[model samples]
Target: MAGTNRILVIVTSVGEYEKAGYRTGLWLGELTHFYDVAEQAGFAMTIASIAGGHVPLDPESLAHDVLADLGTDKRYADREFMDKLTDTVPVADVDVEDFDAIYLTGGHGVMFDFHQSAALESLIARFHETGRIVSAVCHGPCGLLDVTLSGGEPLVRGKDVTGFSWPEEELARRADVVPYSLQDRLKQLGASYSTAEKPFATYVVEDGLLITGQNPGSAKAVAEAVVGRLR
Candidate 1:
C-alpha cells in the first residue's frame, strides 16, 4: 500500500457473435499485456465487467500467430491470472475510491456493451473528476464515449485521444460487423481523435489524466505511460 497503485481494469462481459459461432470479449492481449507491464512495476490490478462474472477473450488474440507476437500467453497460462478473468467484479460493485486509475480493455464485443452501460460511464466520470487516471486502449476507449464529467462537459471533449481507427477496423475485417466507427463516434463527441500512420502500429496519446492507445499493439506502451504518470 505504501508504494503501490491500485488499478481498476474494466473489461466487457458480452462475448457477442454467439449466433455466428465465435465470441468476442475483451482482447486478451490488451488486458494481459497491460497487466504484465503494470504488475511488473508493482501496481495492483482488479479485473471487472459491467455485468460481473467471467469475461472471455477474443479468440483470435490468443491464436498461435498472435501469441507469437504478444507476451500474453504467460498470463493465459498463469492460473492466478486466468482465475481473475474467470470471476471478475461487476462495475457497479466497484468503489472509485479504492483505485488510483481505471483502465478499459478492448475487443469487438465491447462495441456492443461498453458504451451502453451508465454505471461504467459514471465511474469513468468519477475517476476523471477526482484527478485519477482514466485510460483505455483500442476499442477500450468506447467506454469513454458517453462519460460526462461532474461539470457536465463530455470527458473527452477537446481531449487529444486515439483509439482503434477506422482503417484498423477495416483491416481487421470487422468494419461491416461493428456497430459503429469508434474513431468517428469519438470525434463526433468532440474528442480530437487521431491515430498512428500505420494501421497496426503502436500509438498512444496522453492528455492530462486521460490516456488512450491506438490498438492492441499499443497496450503495453499505454500501461507504461500510466505507470509513469502514477509515479
Candidate 2:
C-alpha cells in the first residue's frame, strides 16, 4: 500500500496472424488472471496496447478448456472489464510517472508488435531505470526483447526470466506461426530463461525488479509477486 498503487497493463494491438491465416491478440485469461489478482490487492490498472484502439482476442484462448479454471467467466460476462480491451490507451500517450509498474500480457499477436514499439521500449526502460517492476507473462516478454537501458545494454541481459518456452510453443502447436521463439530470443539476449517442469504449469521468476511468468497458468502468481513487490 505504500507504493504508487498504479499498474499499466500492456496488451497486444496486432491481431493479424497472416502466417497462419488466422487472427490472434491478447490471451483474455492472461489479462483477466493478472487483472483480477492485482485489482484485489488495491492496484488501479490502466489497460494499454502497442498501437491502442482495439485489442483482439486470441480466439483459441477463449476455448472452454483454457478458460474453465481461469476465473474469467465473470469477466467475460462483465462489459466493464471486457470493454477495456475495445479502446485501450496507446503506450505513447501514457504518462510514465503515473505508474509504479508495467505488466505485459501475452498472446501470439504480441510476437508481431511487442518488440516493435519504441514507445513501449522507452516506457519500459524508464520503469526499469527508476527501479519500478517490469513484468511480463507468456509471450508478453517479447516487449522486453528490444528494450535497452541507459547503461547501453538490453534490459534482459544477465537476468533470470521466463515466458512461453520453445517446447511450450510446440505443445501449443504455435511453433510454426509465432514469428520467433521467445525462449530462444531470451537466451540469445543472455537471460537465464526457465520454465515449469511441465509445459503450461504455473511458473514465475523474480530476478530483482524484473518479473516474468512462464505461461498463462503463471499469470496469477506473477501478479501476486508484483503485488508483493509493491507491498
Candidate 3:
C-alpha cells in the first residue's frame, strides 16, 4: 500500500486585498466532502493552494445550517483536521507527479487568483498529460481556464462541465462577496456547460480527465465521481 494513490486537494488562497480585507477561501462543505471520503478510502491527502499558507473560508459556508446536514457529521468540530488547512503546498513549488489526482476546492476568492496563476496552470497541464484525474467544483473551475492540453487546446474546450452558474452568481452577489462569474467565463472559453433546476443543487459532469460540479452543494457528488473514476 505504499502508493495507494495520493490525492492533492487545492484550496483557493486569495482574499480581498484592498483596505479592510477579510480572509476568504474555500467553502467549508467543499473541503469536508472529499476530506471525509478520501480519508476513509485510504487515500493520502495534502491540502494546498496557489500560495503556501493561510487558506481562508467563506463566512456564509460556515453557517450552522450548512454544516449541520452535510454527509460528514463531525466536519465542523474537527479542530485537528481544520489545522491542517493552515499549511498548504505552494502550487509553484510542488511537483504534480507526486499526486495521483488533483481536486480543486472553491470559494468566491478563487476568481481573484486561480485563473491567473501560471504555476497552477503548469501543474494542471502536467497532471493532464500524465492521465491523472483533474477535478474541481464551483468557482474552482476558474483554475481550469488556464489549463491547456499538449495540443494547445484549453482542457475544458469541448468538455462537458458545470460550475457556479450566472444565476447563482447573481444570488451570491445579493448575499456575499464574488469577484466574477465562473459560468460566464467558462462559456466564453467554449466549454459546453449546463446545470440543475436550482443553482445550488448537486450536479456533476465527467468528461475524460476533467470532472466538474455546479456549486458548493455538488462538492460531495463531484468528489465521489472523481473517486469513482480513479478506482
* lDDT for residue 113 in candidate 1, whole number 0-100: 85
Deviation in angstroms for 105 in model 3?
0.5
TM-score of each: 0.96, 0.97, 0.92
**Clashing residue pairs found in predicted model 3:** 25-56
Best by lDDT: 2
lDDT of 2 by residue, 92-179 (tens): 9998799999999999999999899999999999999998999999999999999999989999999999999999899888788778
lDDT (10s digit) by residue, model 1, range 95-196? 999999999999988887889999999999999989999999999999998898888889999999999999998899877678889999999999998888
Q: In model 2, which regions exceed 4 Å deviation?
A: 2-4
lDDT of 1 at 88: 88
- Cα lDDT of model 3 by residue, 1-231, tens digit: 524888888888876633235656678888898777777777789988888888888777777787775744476687888888788778898888789899988887888888889999889889988999999998889999978878989988888989889898777663345555677778888999899998788899889878999888888888788777777
Best by TM-score: 2
Each prediction's RMSD to truth:
1.5, 1.1, 2.3
Q: Which 10 residues in a row give candidate 3 its minimum summed lDDT?
A: 15-24
